[model samples]
Target: MAESAIEVLGVVRPVAQVRHMECGVVLRASDAVALTRAIGADELLLRVVQRVYLLEQRCATLSAALDALGASLRQPRAQAGAPNAAPLEPADASGVASEADAPQRAQQVVRCAAFPRTLEKRATDTLHERGFLVRPSNYDALACLVYMHGFYCVGVATKEDFGGALWEKPRTASDRAEGPSEQKRARAVHGSQQLSEDGGGAAVEAAAHNDSAATRMRQTSAPVCRAYYKLKELGSRELVAFSDCSVAIDVGASPGGWTSYLAERGCSKIIAIDPAELRQTEPPPPCVEHLRQKLQDALPGLLQRKGLAADLYCCDMNAAPSLVVELFTQAVPLLKPGAQVVLTFKNVYPKKRVWEAERDAQLDRLRSVADDVHLVQLFANTPRECTVLCRAKQSTEQ
Candidate 1:
């Protein structure tokens, strides 16, 4: 089989946007091929697809689906658990899956709907019944997504094959220049297919990525204010360990949403910079020092302090992207080498393409002072807003 062997099974609708957003297309052959062609071709789809599935069988009922699934699995799988597809033309030594593609476990996508809600138990049972090992894994999963009407689609791929799988999870220095994964390029090449301007077919044709975070965000509650939940969601991945930072600066920390998060992380010295009263300070956060002034004025006072260095600087200031970046840039000089920064670019404008284009331009400015800048549209964020993560330049790892 070639590396770029599998086709998209169908539109994988995330449950949250099934009714509200433009999605919920049932996967069909024509749509899958059209979507497959667009995978690397379309600027959007390249970031959207997490995994490619070779549709083996689809059944209406959960039991019948697994029964058919068992039969498909019984067939000799591609050598070393490669999916039932041809490889993209081999590129180099780095292009191979090697042992990374080995059959691990049958995992399920966290976003899509599951019928009978007993999907996990039943899947475990079927794998056991078929005489297969069932060691579950989130890193490299042979995933299944159950759509509306008990529709089921099972596919095989590895963490590398779906190289974009972790793209949204975290940011790293190497990822800045790493265009696409070598394994991804080796297995899947761009097909020059474009979705028609009339988005009727695309509603269900090209579904979005899995792991919808918006649903999780709505379910979350915070003591200070809802803004606290943003950092809670941001740090939940453990990619940027907030606990490692002893000192932090929460810009625009009024209602104290983000300030509360730093306290929870056990950050020793926190400067809450804002003019408005901090509602969370009524109780007076033990680790926080409230700077009751604008950031520019607060900077002079903060510099006078004998030992002033920040390990983390976080801002979710409700302002234009340009103003936000400008304010964030001013604080870069006060940070310890390699201090991490987090900012949320609010969706003040209506269009994604326009804001995103402007967003990247602002991010490039950070290049002078920071490296490994990442712009991600998080599930926890509002529809158009995005999260930016970067490390201060000229910093050594602590």
Candidate 2:
């Protein structure tokens, strides 16, 4: 009940504090006063409920222990004077159930989970007065305690752990002068109570609001999928430019997210090629052409029939980097002298050395065809993957 009302420190959601006690069962308590007020329960009534819940949990734990012990003891016991024979020890004597006595411990405790919250001294003192032992904890000891006990233990974190959790430092006088916009933005991004340390050890307020403006801008003009965000990062940096009537090609453009983005940015005509089905919320604009086929298979016919010479080319294929280079090289004759090409390089190798080598090779191939090549890790990309933006040289040079 206390967990229900008391907010979990360093977390935005309070419900995250609720811990499971067993399979299909949960135990939650809140500050007595808060619980009473919320449920219209008097102090005595709350205490009665708390006692009942505690009794139920103890019963469940005891029942599971007895079941495990019974199953173990059922196995053939050693003869009266056998070398391995030992006297039975009382379960309550050491406050520990031995593995020899309880091999089913894992099964017994599998459903149980504990909730631990770092609390101020006053709260710990209150719990202690109510007969709860609030132990002090370091991150390492916390895991050991939880594992040894087979249940949750409430404890306070060490100074180092506490310091790490409080990431924001108090803003200076200059920061306050930056205006309410920053403060408002921080609150919008991080819903949690953010505190920065002051000189006196008191906490000052700070929020993760530095990128609020960009987040808002993105929300207002949200694109179809995550692909839009990658392109937005590139476009916002002025990495590539597009004109009103610029012809473009989107290889592996299944879903047409990039095609839609290009259309909105004033590219007059686009050849979107993918063997997979295209998914769109609405029918595409007249300038857009969706070819349900692979880029390699369709490019030659498209070039011959339409005399296609694209001003912009985009590809995001999950294939080898060498294949990507070959695709661009083959399409060079159908690209304008300085056509812009934006592609993604996926790091398929698990090892760092292999990944770097593959990436470097891709960039080298890219440089051979384009005068300028920029490889950047886009926010939308997974670990080690990057987006490559380049401008193709003339066919004579190619």
Task: Provide C-alpha RMSD values for all models, in order.
Answer: 15.8, 21.4
Cα TM-score of candidate 1: 0.47
Query: TM-score of each candidate?
Result: 0.47, 0.47
lDDT of each: 0.55, 0.48
lDDT of 1 by residue, 48-151 (tens): 33334434344555555555444434433443234333322222334223223344445322211122223545665565655654432222334343444345
Each model's total of backbone clashes: 16, 6
lDDT of 2 by residue, 1-398 (tens): 44444432121212333332111113233332233234332322221121111111111243333332233322232211111112121335343333355332222110011222222333324333433333321111111011112322221122222211222222222333343355444332222222222111111122222323223322443345446556656676677775523899888786566877788888888888888766554655887888888877887688786567788988887776777778888878778888898888877777889888988988997898897898877545655468988888965475
Segments in model 1 whose C-alpha atoms lie over 4 Å from true places: 1-221, 395-398
TM-score of 2: 0.47
- The residue-level lDDT of candidate 2 at 256 comes to 60
